[model samples]
Target: MPLYKTITPNSQTTVKIWKITESYQDLMAKVNLKPVALERVLGMKSELHQRGFLSVRHLLQEFGYTDSDLFYDENGKPHLKDGKHISITHSFNFSAVIVSDLIVGIDIEKQRDKIAVIANKFIDYEFDYLNKMEGDYVKKLTVIWCVKESLYKLFATPGLSFKQHCLVIPFTLLDAETVAWIDYEDKKHRYNIHFFEFEGFTCAYALV
Candidate 1:
């Protein structure tokens, strides 16, 4: 069975995360699903995460949805039935879903050793609070990536660069509280980005 958590941003917005411990095949079996139904779902993987999204969508269907109920626009943004807002992401054995009356996004990440090698690529001001010497520093890297990724999903733009456009305020994984912003045209948009690390993975979600 996958571990699941839900975050309620307000009265109308709810974000949910699904974490997996078994292989894709095992997860599919849990829901009595067919893997062949996952054609577009395979695109989410940049490395090993490719098939992860399929599992997430399949799990969603198990709850009360069909694959066709989810659609993507010409700009590659996802839309729910009749155009309700939706954002989705999966990394390794974890996946997340965000549905709101307004714009929303979510991301999940596995703590990996290579995160330190490419910190500058996606994190800006967040580095101020990041010290590689800290305990479980790799977990912190996952948190930062999740924050930036959520911002990217919310921005929903082809050219919105994470490092340049999204900024996460200084925070710690132990603190479990962090802030983030997207300053476009001097109109700063802020979000209360939340982080949680459990069972070797980190998940983040926000509404701005």
Candidate 2:
């Protein structure tokens, strides 16, 4: 089991990351999936996605849960049957899960220059502080993207627009933490965002 790292952001919240170095068959043999999950995995056209899906089940096991203990809401957010909050993400070769007594979200994304091309789609006020000429521009963009993605997962609202509603406070790469807001429907919500990079990928999580 390549359980790469574990983080306890608070007494009630835990984050686990998995570095996927297993074959799809190997990962499949290690996890027992519910019928629906099994069918879903079998239907994935990309083997990488199948392995990512299976690796998440392995992370759930690390948190003392199983495939049967997880379900999705109408908005596609994951929930725990035991009433604990849960969020999951997987990118290329990495997968992660965050479980907390408080509402929480997590995301892992491969840092790529291509993300800058679509920055305008999900970025708004953040552009004021982002300097495209900066050496860490791509890294910073990846962090912001991860942070908003986490917020989206936690909010799970259908109309929340990342560009128009979600805003990440400015911070340097060294900060490793920042604040983000969801300004929507005449109300504002705040969340603490923490992020880190490993093996050319970024992982971030949000909590109230």
Candidate 3:
């Protein structure tokens, strides 16, 4: 099933990650997609994306759910039929989902050098503490990006700017945990951030 790793951040939340080592046919046969989902997969131009989409359904099955039990809101956020919160993310050769009684968000991103080139656009308060001259700069940048993205998905709020609205506290790679806050609409929200790395990719999850 290629269920690479599973983590229970709390009693109510479960995180499942899939390492895409199966053929498209292999994955497609493992899960049944609804008519709309079938059409969506058929419309994808890249086989990698199709596999990622199908792999998510497999994860759902692991949690005793199915494609029919999921739906998306007008904001494009995914929701569970039973009213639990759900967030999904897929990157090259990997996919992940998190289901929790509390609001949650998950993001998986491949480590790349390009993140350094555009770090200014999304980084504000963090720049002061980041040691750009260090060897782990790219890793730090990627973690910050993932943290902000997870928060974005959790909030699902429109017109939110990563640079202006979200802030991640500074921490070393060894910390594996940190804090983040979103200031918008005259409100302040905080989240507990936990992260880990595997095979040159970083995945971070946030919970309120």
Candidate 4:
């Protein structure tokens, strides 16, 4: 069994997630791939890839879907024949997924000191606001990374720069929640974002 927990925001639409940390056998069986593309990826990176697939599979089962029920669009986004939206993530030992009627994105990261080194890469837009944070720079940094990563998935575009295109509202590190946005020209698409850090892991969600 996958050792995991789940959360569901109070939404009119059916939106939910299955967070897991266990063997991915049952979840993998659901997709029932026939030695095709995604199925073949399983062998290349068993531990990493299996966890992700299992998370999505667990989600499909909740809605009476088998592994074969899931499909990918031309942009490599996962889609369901039932018209439900899905996003998935997997770290070394944990996996998560968010599914809803509208677009959704989920991300999980193992907390590490290395983030400080790459901070400049994603911290440009945030520097203006983060510099004002008196003490908890680490916590603030973690949230910003999560927020930008979630937006990357939400946009389904990896090439977008976090500092240039993604923006997180100014909030103290200790706050459990914050709002963020992605800008395309003058039009700003907003997202509802929330994050939590526990067991040396940081998890976040973005729904638009």
Please, what are the lDDT tens digits per residue for candidate 4 over residues 16-37?
A: 3455555566555555554564
| Model 1 regions more than 4 Å off | 21-51
Q: Write the per-residue lDDT of candidate 1 for residues 46-113, one digit (tens) a residue.
A: 53464476566655664466666776777777787856678888776667787778777788887889
Give the runs in model 3 whose Cα sits over 4 Å from its true position: none
Tens-digit lDDT string for candidate 2 (42-144): 9999999999999999999999999999999999999999999999999999999999999998999999999999999999899999999999999999999
Off by over 4 Å in 2: none
Residue pairs in collision within model 2: none
**Could you tell me every candidate's TM-score relative to the true structure?**
0.80, 0.99, 0.98, 0.82
* Model 4 clashing residue pairs (backbone): 30-67, 31-67
Candidate 3: minimum summed lDDT over ten consecutive residues — where?
1-10
Give me the overall lDDT of model 4: 0.71
Runs with alpha carbons beyond 4 Å of true place in candidate 4 = 13-31, 131-135
What is the TM-score (0 to 1) of candidate 4?
0.82
- State how far residue 25 of model 1 sits from its true place (Å): 5.9
Task: TM-score for candidate 1, please give it.
Answer: 0.80
Q: Tell me the lDDT of model 4 at 95.
A: 66
- Candidate number of the best TM-score: 2
Clashes of each: 2, 0, 0, 2
